[model samples]
Target: MEFHSQQPIHPTIRKCIQHLDVIKADDKTKQIVYMYMESLLRERDLIAASKQEPIESQIHN
Candidate 1:
């Protein structure tokens, strides 16, 4: 679930998420927004971690 990219995000993903964010105005929509944001952040964190050398993998087992 990790993406490895040091450069700027692709326009497609950014725009899609932005659109999703903008579409909701109600409480139910807020729930959707919360889910979307959390997912996006988790994925972004995984991507960043993937880019770095994992500490566990570096040490001899």
Candidate 2:
């Protein structure tokens, strides 16, 4: 997807893209980096979802 001026891309994501471009020949390293990024995204998503829940309900659970 094209990142235009209207859509702000995260700085870390941009850096990862640039890093992957330079290591295209190393599949193992690329896989490790990709997984690390995926885990971070998942953690961020979980945090965001938790914030949307009511504090009372979260405490009850």
Candidate 3:
């Protein structure tokens, strides 16, 4: 699963992710942090997407 493409993240969050390398942690740990941030982005995107206007067409397709 590609995490970065999941959704648009806030600038502050992106900055934090970039700083992950500054932390004294292994690759696996850094990945875990990224995944957590990615999840937050997904949640944010989901909500934003839901707030957008829906299709006017009645067709399910």
Candidate 4:
């Protein structure tokens, strides 16, 4: 849970936290934002993985 000084947080994550704080978001709203963020992160990961795969493999499937 504790992040040491050596490990820096991601900018997107930091921005999300700051936005949530500024809005004084409620629990329900916070949950919605969290879910949206999760989806975005998952999609980004999938895109990155696809890019790493060979073009032939991508074309076949």
Candidate 5:
């Protein structure tokens, strides 16, 4: 279920996750963190997919 080991994230994003005081964050704050992580995963997947495709195909599209 871990997406982190398979994908790389920006240093700032890592720092934010590392520094987050889970015990102190309210429900809303935790939800925001979850959303951010989801977005980051989607962006990483999109970038990886783009790299896998041929440049000619991309140019023609």
Candidate 6:
């Protein structure tokens, strides 16, 4: 997904994704980085949610 100027991710997250000063990332590289970042964010959210839910609820069927 092409991330627009404004989206669900925070400005810092977007900026970090957009501005990686390494060997100079082209469009494809940027997209790859963004995808990786998105996945990381998704995982982070899942972990946070798991933590937020009660341990009993998490263990229950």
User: Which candidate comes out best when scored by TM-score?
Assistant: 6
lDDT of each: 0.62, 0.69, 0.68, 0.70, 0.67, 0.74
Considering only N, C-alpha and C atoms within 3 Å, which residue pairs clash in candidate 4? none
Q: What would the per-residue lDDT of candidate 2 be over residues 1-61, giving only the tens digit for each residue?
A: 2335564546776687567777663656655665677679879999999899987887853
TM-score of each: 0.46, 0.60, 0.55, 0.64, 0.55, 0.65
Superposed Cα deviation of residue 10, candidate 4 (Å): 5.1
Q: Rank the candidates by TM-score, best first.
A: 6, 4, 2, 5, 3, 1
The digit string of per-residue lDDT tens for model 1 on 1-61 reads: 1234575545555565566567745556545655576678779998888779778876887
Residue pairs with clashing backbones, model 6: none
lDDT (Cα, 0-100) at 61 in candidate 5 = 42
Candidate 3's residue-wise lDDT over 1-61, tens digit each?
A: 1235655766776676667656756667767877787788789888888677476543375
Encode model 5's per-residue lDDT on 3-57: one tens digit a residue: 3456575566555655565456655675578568769878999999989998787
lDDT of 1: 0.62
Q: Total backbone clashes of model 1? A: 0
* Deviation of model 5 at 38, angstroms: 0.7
Error of 3 at 47 (Å): 0.4
Determine which window of 10 residues in candidate 1 has minimal summed lDDT.
1-10
The alpha-carbon lDDT assigned to residue 2 of candidate 6 equals 53
User: In candidate 4, how many Å is residue 47 off?
Assistant: 0.8
- Find the 10 residues in a row with the least total lDDT in model 5: 1-10
lDDT of 2 at 31: 54
What value does the lDDT take at residue 29 in candidate 5? 71
Record all residue pairs in model 1 with backbone atoms less than 3 Å apart, i.e. clashing.
none
